[model samples]
Target: MNSRQIKLTVSYLSILLISCVSGTHYLFSVYSISIQERLNFSSVQINTIGSACNYGVFLGKPVLGYFVDNYGARRVCFAASILIFAGFSCLALTYEKIFPTSFLLCAFYLFWTGVASSGGAVSFLTTTAKNFSSNRGTAISIPLALLGLSAFIYSQINMHFFDDTFHFLLFIAFTAGLCMSFGSLFLVVIPAPQHVSDTIESGSNDSISRDDQRIEQTPLLNKNNSNTINRDQIELDIGGWQLLRNKDAISMILILVFFAGTGLMYINNVGIIIESLYHASATPHSDAKIKNLLGFHVSLISICSCIGRILIGPLSDIAKNYFDLSRICSLLFAGVWLFCGNLLALLWVHDIDQLWIVSTCIGLGFGVLYGVAPTTCSEYFGSRHFGFNWLVFKSLNLM
Candidate 1:
């Protein structure tokens, strides 16, 4: 392969590693009860801590996205390494009572963890979306899928290798930090070769560089991509107030807020829901059994979500190319799943075992919704300002 191809390959793999480490926040359930029981925190405090982490995840991203867009992902990854390591280390110390136990203090640390998560995510995703314009959906989905699987990976490690919650937190800190540090070395934007005609048509300066003219003469842009949508849509560079004024952008924000909010509620509190159901059923299972079930459900959700992320990307590509359908079809399908999942959770889930059904639906729905969203934004708003636009779109989850 050529040097540019090699760079793309290395960058893709590096981003995958960073993504796997970035999602430690998804493992909140694995350690939430331990923090509560050992530190004497109430349910209200526990929920608040979860909220703090989530708020950091979404709210911190706009700034991080802006930096990633302007300064490149390397600096963002390095900064994320520091934030995640410090955040998790502080939480571990508090859990062990090495630091005085304050719920607010723990919440503060967890918030940074969330911010760190967003930093890693925004960096990798922005790089991917910018670099892989031809098959952006398939390209973005791999890392996104791995990110969904991160909670499962960590939970299994904790279950097998660490008995203490303190050690588990430390493990996440070091592993995630080191991965981001490593990824900083390779995560970079490889600019898509712009065709001069397209650039001129988009109202660029009439002047064209020698390199641009040479690339335009090559067959690079002539490759058969029957499965991809219109290239003109992909070249849109609109941003700032123009993007905000867009009716499509406004509609996306509303839809994502509703769907993402529902998914986050279930994701953040699935552990509590499982506990309540177990208790209500009057089952005589041991605490150990309950813990095992919790891990099982978390893993199950992660697995299903991973599958959904992988599936939706290529499916949407196929739909657009083969059926002349819009990406909104995928979103509608995800909405159906969310509606059914929530309905089932409310009306049908009484036993812990039956909870897997709800988990399956929600996981798949959440995965597809998120998986389709970034590419949709890039297609609709343009990858030129994707980092800022995508993150700003996601920040609506705060509502």
Candidate 2:
């Protein structure tokens, strides 16, 4: 209810909107089949194109984070909006064979769009992490949860607004880009408490400016949190390479790699996976039926994924605050669902209907993993170097 909280609320809404639009990259399967058929793309080629968006996010994270750290998220988000707009526009044109490019070129265009989307996504995460100290988990969960819901939102949009595949692509380009532009216009970065601390301590505050003092007195820096936050910041400042040498850092990376790999394998190959399951069960399908089935599964995945992401943040807070659980414990909790999902898919998923359960668990697990990892990474490494550190460690998600 305070002005600071109000500003935080506004920023939260902006970032969530941006994330919801940009994170549609995860729904590549929805349009991949149509694209493949139209372009006469091979399976490998289609997969490569689908993976390009994520790869763009993975590869661009460090760069985007660096800009976010130095210049703040607003500028970076604006640039991202432009990139997404141009990339998608170019993609639509390419689909129409306007430039007569190969599939590789098309993949590159998608990759470029993804890079832009990553800027928006990372900006949101970094902004939230930098601004909030208490309840960091819940703060981040808001936007990230929406990001997980992107697929569902897009699915509904396609189902209701756009009838054809080609039109859907154009609409994504126009609508998502417009949303990103609006988000960029609205986003504002809050200075970190530590930075404000240093400024006040350095005699930067005039006599009448007592807000800084009140800020210093805020419970965000009490004995319980300040010590932990300071310690994390110190460890994060130990240089990225040196921090990489830490056992905790290595473990986090490996855990992310494992969970991310499990989820991404399904995401990238979702269409084929569903088809294979349908065939195995001798489920007869018309084109409309297949599309409907895929949409239903995707909707389920998005719904569960969003719910998992939103809930896990607060759950981690509970475990951390009440049970004195470490970040690793929160991570292991995430791994539980990932393991179960994969296990069910591998051992028991012999029919189309059973794949529904697998998708739910996998989506839930993936969402939870993404939800907590960034703030946890910032806690372990330090918020100062969070951008680069998170990017490096999180590359495992792409793998």
Each candidate's number of clashing pairs is 0, 1
Tens-digit lDDT track of model 1 for 295-326: 88888788888999989998888776656577
Query: Which prediction has the highest lDDT against the true structure?
Result: 1
Tell me the tens digit of each residue's lDDT in model 2 across 1-399.
877778877887888889888787777878787778778999989888878888887889888887887788888888888888877777778777786658888899889888987888888888777777667788888788898899899887876777678678788888888888898776886654565465434433342243445543333324543322222222235335786789888888889988788887887788888766776676666667667777887888888889988998888777766565776776777889889988998899887887888888889888888888887887767677676677777665665
Lowest-lDDT window of 10 residues in candidate 1? 225-234
TM-score computed on alpha carbons, candidate 2: 0.88
Where model 2 places Cα greater than 4 Å from the true spot, the runs are 192-239
Clashing pairs in 1: none
lDDT of 1: 0.85
Would you list the clashing residue pairs of candidate 2? 236-381
lDDT of every predicted structure (CA atoms): 0.85, 0.77
TM-score versus the correct structure, for each prediction: 0.92, 0.88
